[model samples]
Target: MVQTTPLVDRFGRVATDLRVSLTDRCNLRCSYCMPAEGLAWLPDERVLSDDEVVRLIGIGVSRLGIREVRFTGGEPLVRRGLSGIVARTRALDPGLELSLTTNGLGLVRLAGPLAEAGLDRVNVSLDSIRPETFHRITRRDRLHDVLEGLQAAADAGLGPIKVNAVLLRDVNDDQAAELLAWAVERGYELRFIEQMPLDAQHGWTRESMVTAEETLERLEKEFVLAPAAEPRGSAPAELFTVDGGPATVGVIASVTRPFCGDCDRVRLTADGQVRNCLFAREESDLRAALRSGVPDAEIARRWVSAMAGKRAGHGIDDPTFLQPDRPMSAIGG
Candidate 1:
């Protein structure tokens, strides 16, 4: 139950969702997210223990009125005892909608167990369908592994599985229909995201990012998209369907069309940092306070304060904006 607690953000807006990063490590280095030089992994000591993670989630669910919990990571499934973590959270509250985002490299091995452990949904990060293009984008030669993982996810009933493809103009813009056709046929939701200014690696230019408008224009030519009415106050993705109820699609136009006004969510990194906005430079370190014997209430107090200071919006609207200093891996996209 939510009790009397109201989840309020910096602007006195109520928050209904929380994104938790399970780890700050990743197996595949997507060119858009990570640089060829690589990122410095957070020290092992800084990562939250399963107990701490559950504790934070409990506070979020109870005091912060968080109805949805999404596990992100360097790759969340890479963490040992992930099934146990998911199981513990499932036992917390039936009303909680628990979801996990992964690179889908190892979903084949863990999807059934995770589903049985009570994960409600799974979102896989897939950019290109071509093995060679996929390898070129993620720098990992495991396209077959990801495909199997997606199938395993569906087979395990950890769906409706969503495929999150970042449509960069030159990279995989041409594959929009290919990605959606497979998902709509199998009844999977596919959401193509406009690459944001989080990490614009390899000469990332505005011209390189395929806008949501372009993607829809291209897809509408093939399968007609009808408005799929969505609940008020949701994530960046705007819902749409393919004429019938068999399959649907969505587009998250963070770059071309920002959704910061109705953004009522916060991201907690694996190292215990709270990022109020993905494109904001401000972040608060909560791990130090959490480990220093701060009670849950006090921890929640600081958390609210940190969230209260969130910017009105990310100013990618500025004509000459540079990408944020931190990589997406650190921010847990």
Candidate 2:
């Protein structure tokens, strides 16, 4: 039987947003996310099958009160069954919000199919507009391909397409204003995310990061910015209107200014573990329970129990805090 009670934590936060990792594999090896050599990919047997993913999503929506679902990955487009997965989820609830986060490598060919399959929009990870800078950051010369993919997504009618960019201290930090100007020109909502400690190399330090304040300062040099009137709600990005108009940019200051108090997200790793926080050290296993043929109600109850243990905050500011073993790639960004 479906549960009417929402997935509420001890801190009174109700999780309505679900982020599902399609796979722990990505094409590009971004410096801040993974080493150029890349980490060992999850074995096929360990990763959740398409059917399993669809079933769990059904449970989350029908029983657990999930309202929005964002498909993420080391790169979601790497997963072959993504379109089918989106289709199945859409069939579950036509009104459910469905989105995807990708590196934009394969979006050129898959964007239209994905949109037809009911993907509402996309958030592409693009660090630089210059080919050389892009290659330097991602260790790949696929900037041209990513740009084409963004255009293809736009042609596919993916409006309000958001671009996620990370700034490395000396690497692309100078391009902050340039990136926002490019995004505004193309009508893409650009979000500058402060580099976090979730890198595979674990080399991330607070000093090396470009804080939200710094990002705003850079943008202010080229454009006028005022906080958008819209309420932030559970959104990670703090929206700011550029030049006081409809075009806007965002800054996700996960380090300097945490938004954990209003977090309403839960993550399911590609291997089927529930992560209550991006920086969480502990994960609740759902893959074993599914493989053992546990009933849907039991699975839902386990998910609720997992949320009940969520801490008040990610504790990144805490002196003794440690980064999770999984990098942003494995953790589904």
**Candidate 2 lDDT, 18-128, residue by residue in tens:** 999999999998988888898999999999999999999999999989999999998999898889999999999999999999999998999999999999999999999
Residue pairs with backbone atoms closer than 3 Å in model 1 (clashes): 10-308, 25-74
Model 2 regions more than 4 Å off: none
Count of backbone collisions within predicted model 1? 2
Instruction: Identify the leading candidate in terms of TM-score.
Output: 2
| lDDT tens digits by residue: candidate 1, 128-231 | 88999998888889999999999999999888888999987777888898888888777778989888766635356677678888999988888888887766
Winning candidate number (lDDT): 2
Model 2 vs. true fold: TM? 0.99
Evaluated at residue 305, the lDDT of candidate 1 is 84
